[model samples]
Target chain A: MPKVTIDNITIDVEEGTTILNAARKIGGRIVPPAMCYYSKLKGSGGKCRTCLVKVAQSSAKDPRPMPKLVASCSTPVQDGMVVQNLTSPEVAEARKGIVEFLLLNHPLDCPVCDQAGECDLQDLSFGYGMEETATEDDRREFPVIDIGDKIKLHMNRCILCYRCVYVADQLTDKRLHGILYRGDVSEISTFIGNAVTNDFSGNMIDVCPVGALTDKTARFKSRVWFLKPMDAHRACGKCPGKVAIWMFGNEIYRVTGRKDQFGEVEEFICNECRFEKKEPGDWVIEGPRHIKRQSVISANHYEEMKKQSIIDPIAGEMNKQE
Target chain B: MKSLTNRSKVVSNKQMTFWERIYFPAILNGMRITFGHLFRRKATVQYPEATREFSDIYRGKHVLKRDDEGRERCTSCGLCAVACPAEAITMVSAERKPGEEHLYREEKYAAVYEINMLRCIFCGDCEEACPKEAIFLTKELVKSEYQREKFIYGKDELVESPDPAKRVDVSKRQTKEVLEFKKDKRYKHNK
Candidate 1:
């Protein structure tokens, strides 16, 4: 085990653990916002530089600080490593720059985007992004394509995170789609427009940080904030049945894998669970899934817990006498 | 006993004098006050016959605004519905098809927008929350109706006329600072 200090909080973690994972172990504000990093998926980090953190001290032996802010997602923790995330102004500036770069080519159509409310990129921008974009050049536009029957891909919004590619490579057996060209002109597209029909391909939509990939069935139906997220599950043979079903009234609007506080899906759900199941009676809803207070999706959403009543002793005695 | 407030009054039932018993003077004083009111400026107007000038920014009936190009400005983001304290607004959104680009401003537009006028407080929160500047509160008041269902305003009632001549003017509701903010080219949304 190696000891790491992140944002002034000390935590002991395994030697092989990345700085991002170590920070996650500490939890709360100390954890850096990662746009491309998916903990569940292997080789899913180092693409998006949004999780840059200042290394104040390298290790116990060599106490020299790193020359530049390092990507927290890829950087491994060393014994007596001192990391600074929110505490460093340099990291904040670098993170803000990273957000700007990520949103450079992004079409700011959040008003029309389904992922506006729960989008990690949207949250990142709101936290670290500037109000105005500096780029005068027109953003690269690509015709919206459906990778699968269930998923809608808007390439203009993609930050080239490659998380979906990882999902296809690791989770799904036969990888149908991958990043097509080279720098700037590069894009995530299927080879010769072949549709991705794999069972685990739907997880790509869940892994996308932005509105690049969206559920086609729930397209333009309602914003994520309007729908209440509930913890729901049903018996399935393929993958774990546990999922989060977004509901509007009694109707289940859309079904997605239950995402953790970091906005990463815990268990990858199959295509059957993701789509083709809309009925309210299909799944047993446990309760309202807890949404963070800062998230816009949690606005006006609350679930009442079990009622506890305390009877006065005198009133109880009088009731007994009666 | 001492009064806590120190402003207590004593009640007495005494015999009246001849002039007091007549009660003519008391009646004459009351008549003078009543007659004086009749000559003063009236506080109210005859609603149907006469009209009062409304404030420029008076929040009354809402208007779903149209852009200068005559396209529907509402993208149906549901910010107005969420910002509404009364929960008066509800809308169903649909993606704009290829030929329907002229009808809507964005790729997605509100297909079935409705506002329950009876539940609306007209606090102008919806107008404030509108990101696209699609919804605004006009000076025109919501009409009274006998049936409860009539109070529920649909897209036909809320959407402003397509003709530029008949467009609802909510410029008064937008302050000078807000107008300037809208005009600022620095912001990407403004551009």
Candidate 2:
């Protein structure tokens, strides 16, 4: 166990817990936004450096504070460590610079972008980026890539967070896609010019922090704010079918992995639920409206593997489906 | 009260003769002034047959611009509607369907865009506010209509020609100040 004091608030955590997780345990108003850190995926942290926080003191064994601000997502919580986050002026300034760099090559075509409302990059940049860009240099541009009929990759929106790559390799059963080249010309591409289509390619779009990757079926369909997400799922032969059905009017527009109250997808949904199961009758309605965070967990217990353990509504619904 | 000097108040100098009182000379002077105007350029033009040349900055009926590829440039972000002082602009946006790229410049396109010409002041605020360079105030004046509903211009009437050559050309309407602002290269991807 490790006892750490972050911003005068002390907390205890398990040995391997990083400062970002320790901040999450501290809870209210502390967790620094992690652009590259997906908690479910291992080794997805340390790349973004957006969660930098100062360590004012350390354990007696070290006896000295760290030389520079450390990335909170990767730094292990040392016993008796003193961390300064939100209240620290230096950390906030550095974070503003981090956000500025993330937005340096990002296109300002938010009007046409599908991820305008629910985008993490949009929210973070609005919260931390400079109002006016200091650089007058030309921004990097890339042609939009359509990877099969399922996903569209707008490389201009990418900040190279590696969350999608991490999900594609670690969370799913494929590694056909990865970043190619290096430096400013780096791009996410399929291996040997192959099309990046695997069963779980749909989830990559959900894990993306920007509009870099998007659901082709749902692209240019409806703005996220206008669409109402409902709890819906169906019988599946392969993976768990539990998912959120986004609808506009009477039409079921699209389906994706359902997120819990924390906005993280609770379980990775497979392609059958995302693409093939499109009709209204293919699904059994799970719970009340999924528009609010409080209802997300209650509405999301339909994952097939865990279907029996949670509740037994399938007996009646199975007859209904048949 | 009387004038200080009698000469200052001396009535019509020397009583007018009867011939002068008839005022033929005064009538002739009025005719001369009227005839002078006839020789100068005509003030009223014969409209419909011969149109008057409007000034360069004349803001008239609105036209939604299309890109050179003949795709509608408006993503329907509603900036033009928000910028309109008279609240004459209204629009609805929809996602671009697959294979519709040639019809729309972006993933989102204006499903319905309308402007109430009766309420619009033609101030060109919507023109300046548009980020995609989609909407412009053209030199074409709004025609007089018999019904209030007829004054509203829908996307069908507002959109420019799909043919690039026949498209509603508003380049000549932009001022020097606007041209300088449009030269900003900070947002390359957007341009």
Largest lDDT belongs to which candidate?
A: 1
lDDT for each residue of candidate 1 in A1-322, tens digit (9 for 90 to 100): 8999999899999988999999887777778999989999888899889999999999999999999999999999999999999999999988888889998899889999999989988889999999877777778989999987888999999999999999999999999999999999999999888999999899999999999999999998889998899998999999989999999999988999999878899899999998978999999999998776677888888866322313465654343231
Residue B65 lDDT in candidate 1: 90
DockQ of 2: 0.26
Q: How much DockQ does model 1 earn? A: 0.71
User: Best candidate per DockQ, number?
Assistant: 1
How do the residues A1-322 of candidate 2 rate in per-residue lDDT, one tens digit apiece?
Answer: 7899888899989998999999877765567888888787778889778889999887746858889999999999889998999989998899899988888888887888877666778777887888777778777888787876788889989989888898888766768788989988898877765776677778888888788998888776665655567788777876678888877666778887886533467778887788777778888877534443222122332333335524666664443221
Model 1 segments more than 4 A misplaced: A304-322, B1-32, B181-191
iRMSD per prediction, in order: 1.7, 3.5
In model 2, the Cα lDDT at residue A96 comes to 94
lDDT of 2: 0.79
**Model 1 Cα shift for residue B69 (angstroms):** 2.0
Which portions of model 2 show Cα errors greater than 4 Å?
Answer: A60-63, A260-263, A286-322, B1-72, B78-108, B111-130, B133-153, B160-180, B189-191
Quote each prediction's TM-score.
0.90, 0.69
Task: Give the per-residue Cα lDDT of candidate 1 at A308.
Answer: 32
